[model samples]
Target: MFNKKHYKFNLNSTFAKLLGSYLIIISLILTTSSLVFFRKYEKLIVTQEYNLSEKLLNQANYYVDFNIQWATSFLYSLYLDEDIYDLMFSQSSHYKKNGISKLKHLNLSSSNIDSIFIYNKFDDKFYSSLGSPAENYYLPSMKNIIYKSKNTFTDAFIPSQIKINLKNNNITKNIISIAILTSKSSEKSLSSAVILNLNANTFSNYFKHNITNNSNLFVMDNNGT
Candidate 1:
């Protein structure tokens, strides 16, 4: 015969076991909910950062383009100046001296302009903001060394010594040099170069001001090279 009495349920002990199981289930549910909330918060932060980075990059591009356009306009004005042409064509030493000084003064006044160089194809001479015969002159043989790409802005090139003042304890300064080749409708060719010594600290400060969280901001060129 089956032992029905021994198998009978104990009400208090059974209730205690049921209650323990319910508590464990509740703990697991709470843990899962917390984990889900944390993950959602993390994803939101990442998305915000990405959006901010994109906005900054777009602003930087605009700034760079504006700078380039400003430089090109200045160069065109210089090229069209009758005085500049008279100096170059006449081969007059006096005119060259005065013209160089004028160019230097003009260059110094422009914001972000480190130096400016004008290469006279007529005399094969170079004039720069540094005053006399440009120390960093590019010879005729070195012309067109860089590739011409209308779609890309070339990488930044730093000249070892753009200006050296022997009188000032032989101080040498590095400059960020950029060049553009120009051709007139009349088949006349002229090369104009601009050097800008970027103030890194000032630039970084400007970026910080424009960007809310600059930690995620990064800059890269078109080539991704």
Candidate 2:
């Protein structure tokens, strides 16, 4: 006769208990490891994103500061240019032509410079590298430029001088202006200023080129513009 053996599983046996405990410990270890790994990965991703954003911001700030410094230095040089002084104080058209030509050349050579305006208080005349003089209607803003003791940066604004306009009359290109007040003599008040307009797209394009499409960026001064 063939013997048939049947075994029943005993839940309370020492061997069963030991096997259950081993399985429970292994499950716990796996769950804990998974949690720790996940947490570490999440933290690492956050840190990397923070570093990238910080680097981008620093690069943008440096670019803007460098341009401003360059503009400031250019203005300082203009203050020493005899042509500019003659254009402001003298009645000679020759000096005026030379100054205008110089401005035109400079404006043409620079990619970022949008427009250049030289306001002479003596003749109440404005000369521009863009050809036509700034309309006298904007005289208040011009005077404000000459009155400032320090170099001033303006909020993004539609230039009254640049006639280049979009199809919609109201839609005009925004420009940021850097103006410097200058005086030929120490005894005299500032009688002239050079207003240099920079295309707002320059900064925007810079950010676009350096940053990913998914990112959003803003450039603002203390006044929040």
Reference-based TM-score, model 2 = 0.78
lDDT of each: 0.55, 0.69
| Most accurate candidate by TM-score | 2
Lowest summed lDDT over 10 consecutive residues: which window, candidate 2? 153-162
What are the per-residue Cα lDDT tens digits for candidate 1 across 102-147? 7668777755665565556567566666654344443331233222
lDDT of 2 by residue, 1-225 (tens): 999999999999999999999999999999999999999999999999999989988888899888877877776676568887776677778778899899889887778877677877677677777673333334455555556434333323323333433344543455666665554323345556677767777777888999976856777756676
Residue pair clashes in candidate 2: none
Question: lDDT, candidate 2, residue 164?
Answer: 39
